[model samples]
Target: MGVGGIGIWQLLIILLIVVMLFGTKKLRNLGSDLGGALKGFKNAVKDDDSAKNDSTDENQPSENTDESSSETVDITAEKVAEKAEEE
Candidate 1:
């Protein structure tokens, strides 16, 4: 038995029929298109994961905070507001 009870000869015959219906060139083109689509999907997923990591990094407290000052500058908006009021 071949794949799920179908013999090897039967499989070959089916393959021949498929090749006859859709020539070799069309089959090659379809295979390449499918491969390209899969590659693109993989890249998109990787980019999405990296983007998520970047967003999380932005939300967390920065490690580069100035240790010399006791008061921590949480947001840059406060400094901007102060400067605007001074001006």
Candidate 2:
């Protein structure tokens, strides 16, 4: 037989009943309200993500200590090698 014994005709009848109960105007308004609520929820989630990033940045130091020291050592070694090559 059909899906779960509910055929296409039965599904169409149910849809017709629902449309008759709510009417076209009410259904349109309901759809618009649902869309607006979803949009607002998405914006709120994005704002939360941006706020978290800002707070994390504020708590950490801008310059990492280890990286700066390693870079300075590399530059010193390069200069010493250059002077030896000139001799």
Candidate 3:
């Protein structure tokens, strides 16, 4: 009548057997490791979301567009010089 037909008593028996086999210390260490792994995964996901937001913000037009225009001009000059040298 429980999960997949396994009752609460059966689940308790399984947990007891696992504790007996692994000992309390090993189980504690395993729990902590699992907790740390989940925490790290959460932080990574948060950082990825923030990075995406930052990229979108940068793509929007701003008043300081002159800086970007100067960079484009520099790139164009470099390409023109390269073409002249190839001629």
User: Which residues of candidate 1, in runs, are more than 4 Å off?
Assistant: 64-87
Give the higher-TM-score candidate: 2 or 3.
3
Clashes of 1: 0
In candidate 2, what residue range of length 10 has the lowest lDDT sum? 64-73
lDDT of 1 at 76: 88
Q: Model 1, poorest ten-residue lDDT window?
A: 65-74
The stretch of ten residues in a row with the least summed lDDT in candidate 3 is 64-73
Candidate 1 lDDT, 1-87, residue by residue in tens: 999999999999999999999999999999999999999999999999999999999899877877676576667888889899999
Backbone clash pairs in model 2 (N, Cα, C under 3 Å; residues 3+ apart or in different chains), count: 0
Candidate 3 lDDT, tens digit per residue, 1-87?
689999999999999999999999999999999999999999999999999999999998886657657663578889999999999
Cα RMSD to the true fold for all candidates: 8.8, 9.9, 7.4
Task: Supply candidate 1's per-residue lDDT for 47.
Answer: 100
Q: Give each model's whole-structure lDDT.
A: 0.94, 0.90, 0.93
Judging by TM-score, tell me the better candidate of 1 and 3.
Answer: 3
- As for candidate 3, its clashing pairs are none
Candidate 2 C-alpha lDDT tens digits along 20-76: 999989999999999999999999999999999999999997575776566645788
lDDT ranking, high to low: 1, 3, 2
Off by over 4 Å in 2: 1-5, 64-87
- Could you tell me every candidate's TM-score relative to the true structure? 0.68, 0.63, 0.69
Candidate topping TM-score: 3
